[model samples]
Target: MLTPESAAKFQEFTQAAMGRQTQVLINNSVVTEPWIRTPITANRIRNYCN
Candidate 1:
C-alpha cells in the first residue's frame, strides 16, 4: 500500500513518464520494460492471479 505522499509521487512520476517505455528494477536488476499508456494515481495497486 502506498501512503498518500507516495501515491502522489507515483502519480507525478507516471505523468512524467507517459508515452515512454519504463523499466522496473529490483535490487539493481532489470525486471520488465513496459510502455506507459496512462498515469496511475491510485493509492493501492493489486496483482491478480488466475
Candidate 2:
C-alpha cells in the first residue's frame, strides 16, 4: 500500500520530469496515469501498485 507521502513524492517526481520535458520511466508501467497527471491520491497509487 502506498501512503499519502509516497503518493506525494511520486507526484513531485512526475511533475519535475514533465516540467523539464524529460521522459518518465515507470518500473511497473502500471503507474502511467499518475505519472502523467498531477495530484495523485494515495488510493490511486495503491491501486496502481496492486
Candidate 3:
C-alpha cells in the first residue's frame, strides 16, 4: 500500500526526524531504526510494484 504520496510522506517524516536519531512511530510505538530501515523497505516496495 505504498503509494507515491505515502512514500514521500515517509521520507519527509524521517528526514524531519533526522538528528536526535528518533525511530519512526506507528500507533505510538517505534518501528524501525530511524532511517536505516522500515517495516516496508524500498526493495520490498519494488517487488510489490512489479
Candidate 4:
C-alpha cells in the first residue's frame, strides 16, 4: 500500500508522463519500456506480485 504522500507523488509523475513511453528499471537495469496510458489520480493500491 502506498502512503498518501507517495501516492500523490506518483500521481504527479503519471500526469507528467501520460501518453509517453517510459522505461521500468530495477537495480540500474532496464526492465521494460511501456507507454503510459493515463494518469492515475486515485490512491488505490496495485498488486505487482506475479
Candidate 5:
C-alpha cells in the first residue's frame, strides 16, 4: 500500500532521478535501471511512524 508520504517520496525520487544526467544507485544498484526490489511492508512503515 502506498501511503501519502511514501507515494510522495517515491514521486519526488523518480522526478529527481529522471531529471539528472547521472545515474542514481540505491543500495548498490542503479535506481533507473530495472531490477528486482523487495516489496514494501507495513512493518517497516509502522516502526517508522510510531
Candidate 6:
C-alpha cells in the first residue's frame, strides 16, 4: 500500500513524462537518415561471425 505522499509523487512523474512525449511529437521531431538505415547485407553478418 502506498502512502498519500507517494501516490502524489507517482502522479507527478507520469505527468512530466507525458509532457516530454507531447513536446517531441509536436515540436522538433526526432528522425534518422534513410541512407544510414540501409539493410545489412549477408557478407556483413558473416564478418561478425568470424
lDDT of each: 0.83, 0.51, 0.51, 0.78, 0.48, 0.36
Q: Using TM-score as the measure, name the better of candidate 3 and candidate 4.
A: 4
Can you write out model 2's per-residue Cα lDDT over 1-50, one digit (the tens) per residue?
55777777866766666634333346845343333444444445343433
Ranking of all candidate structures by their TM-score, best first: 1, 4, 3, 2, 5, 6
Q: lDDT: which candidate is best?
A: 1
lDDT of 5 by residue, 1-50 (tens): 56778866765555555534444475987655332133333322222211
Per-prediction TM-score to the true structure, in the order listed: 0.77, 0.39, 0.40, 0.66, 0.37, 0.34
lDDT, residue 37, model 4: 86
- Each prediction's RMSD to truth: 2.5, 5.5, 7.3, 2.9, 10.1, 17.5
Q: Candidate 4: which pairs clash?
A: none
lDDT of 6 at 20: 39
Candidate 5 positional error at 40, Å: 16
Q: Write the per-residue lDDT of candidate 1 for residues 1-50, one digit (tens) a residue.
A: 99999999988998999999887677988767777789988998553323
lDDT of 1 at 27: 100
Off by over 4 Å in 1: 46-50
Badly placed stretches (over 4 Å) of model 5 are 19-32, 35-50
Record all residue pairs in model 1 with backbone atoms less than 3 Å apart, i.e. clashing. none
Model 2 error, position 45 (Å): 3.9
lDDT of 3 by residue, 1-50 (tens): 67777877766655555554555457987665434333333321332211
lDDT of model 2, residue 6: 76
